[model samples]
Target: ADMPGISKDRLNVKVEGDTLTIEGDAEIPMPEGMEPLYADVRATHYQRSFTLSSEMDTEKVEASLKHGVLTLHIPKREEHKPRKIEVQVD
Candidate 1:
């Protein structure tokens, strides 16, 4: 079952050694009520975070949120970037 509220592609991750940091937020409307409920909606802010992989590159990470959707683009370092190496023998 998929409960759709907000979705993030990468969530903007940065890996520093063994520490990974993720920062983002979501904007949800308060319940429809004329009067104050149990609690005010002012404190209904949204935020989320996560710990990333140790191999992630922190310097090339990017994140953005628009229209309630979040996008994260994490680019690894050249050394960490995935590629095939060819060897030549003469």
Candidate 2:
């Protein structure tokens, strides 16, 4: 399903260890000629949680949003990522 009203920019996310938290607000527009309907459709705050894999490095996690588009870049830990090492033997 496509959530046209809900885009990436309208949200904020934070990740910790194997868990990720998503928080954001959504705006709802009122229809025309709906004066009789008494309702409060303001942007409501929301939160969600998710479990991540062990390969993720919570310390290097980064996120940014522009023009209603959100982007998150999670870099791996130095020790966990591939690196060249020298072999020392006696």
Candidate 3:
């Protein structure tokens, strides 16, 4: 996710059952000792939700935010992973 201007401290990520939620607050700070006469950008709240599949391992999900980009790594369950079987010569 491209979340420019949002700090990591103001971001929240949570997973409940099959639901995954992401919330954050975006605020434009004013320069010190300067008052804004008119501001085009203002503070805003952002939220997004997603439903995870059973094949995904929720417990092993990983999240990281850097350079205003949020990244999520969701790995497949053990049973869902591809397996190789070798056949024995009868």
Candidate 4:
């Protein structure tokens, strides 16, 4: 996710059952001793939810945030991974 201007500490990721939820707050702070008289940008709250497939392993999900970008890695279940099949010729 391209979440520019959002701090990692202000982000939250959670998975429950088949639902995945992401929540965060975005705020722009003003300089010390400076007050905003006519500001166009305001604080914002963001939340997104997704339904995970049965083949996805929620227990092994990994999340990382760097340079204002959020990344999620979800591996498929062991049984759902592709396997090579051997052919026997008689």
What lDDT does the true structure give each of the candidates? 0.53, 0.67, 0.89, 0.88
TM-score of the candidate numbered 2? 0.56
On a 0 to 100 scale, what is the lDDT of residue 41 in model 3?
A: 52
> Candidates 2 and 4: which is better by TM-score?
4
What lDDT is obtained when candidate 3 is compared to the true structure?
A: 0.89
Cα lDDT of model 1 by residue, 14-64, tens digit: 555656555433335456776454643343334444666656666777766
Clashing pairs in model 3, backbone N/Cα/C closer than 3 A? none
Q: Write the per-residue lDDT of candidate 4 for residues 1-90, one digit (tens) a residue.
A: 866667988899999999999888887777999987986545467789999999999999999999878999999999999999999999
What is the C-alpha local distance difference test score of candidate 2? 0.67
State the lDDT of candidate 2 residue by residue for 1-79, as single tens digits. Answer: 1122455666768776699887777666657866535544444666677787787888777876665455678787777
* Rank list by lDDT: 3, 4, 2, 1
Predicted structure 4: lDDT: 0.88
Candidate 3 per-residue lDDT, tens place, 1-90, comes to 877778989999999999999999886787799988886555478899999999999999899999889999999999999999999998
Which scores better on lDDT, 1 or 3? 3
For each of the candidates, the C-alpha root-mean-square deviation to the true structure, in angstroms, is 6.6, 5.9, 2.2, 2.0
Q: Which candidate achieves the best lDDT against the true structure?
A: 3
Report the Cα lDDT for residue 18, model 3: 99
Model 3 segments more than 4 A misplaced: 32-43
